[model samples]
Target: MKLNVLYFAWVRERIGVASETVETDAGSINELLDELSAREERYAIAFSDRSVLRCAIDQTLVPFETSLANATEVAFFPPMTGG
Candidate 1:
């Protein structure tokens, strides 16, 4: 399946891209993360801390274990704080 992966905040800085299209066979967000983290050193660094990350599939917030069935997009970012 093809997924449009989106990065924000520090994640974008770490990975050096805001977004990219990736071909993956992952069944869930966690699985997709594993695939990405293994791709290169940058990816590994970007996803190194799962506890500080939040995921949203198709614009809806979901858990890491959430299934990726029929999903076209996946977004990863850190929690927000008041400015």
Candidate 2:
């Protein structure tokens, strides 16, 4: 399936991209991360610590196990801290 992957904050810096169109065979978010992590050093650095990352599938925050079958967008970002 095709997914719009979005990166935020430091994650975007490491990946060198804010968003991308990805064709994935991943069934879940975790699987998608694994695929991205294998793409390059940047992905490795960006996704190294999964605990520090937050995700949303099609605008709804979800766990990594969330299914990606019908998702149009997936966003990844660092945990937010209010000022």
Q: For model 2, how does the per-residue alpha-carbon lDDT over 1-83 read when each residue is reduced to its tens digit?
A: 99999999999999999999999999999999999999999999899999999999999999999999789999999998999
lDDT of each: 0.96, 0.96
Candidate 2: give the clashing pairs. Answer: none
| Candidate 2 residue runs with Cα over 4 Å from true position | none
Q: What is the C-alpha RMSD of each candidate to the true structure, in Å?
A: 0.8, 0.6
- Cα lDDT tens digits for candidate 1, 1-83: 99999999999999999999999999999999999999999999999999999999999999999999999999999986799
Can you give the lDDT of residue 10 in candidate 2?
94
Q: How close is candidate 1 to the true structure, as a TM-score?
A: 0.96
lDDT of 1: 0.96
lDDT of 2: 0.96
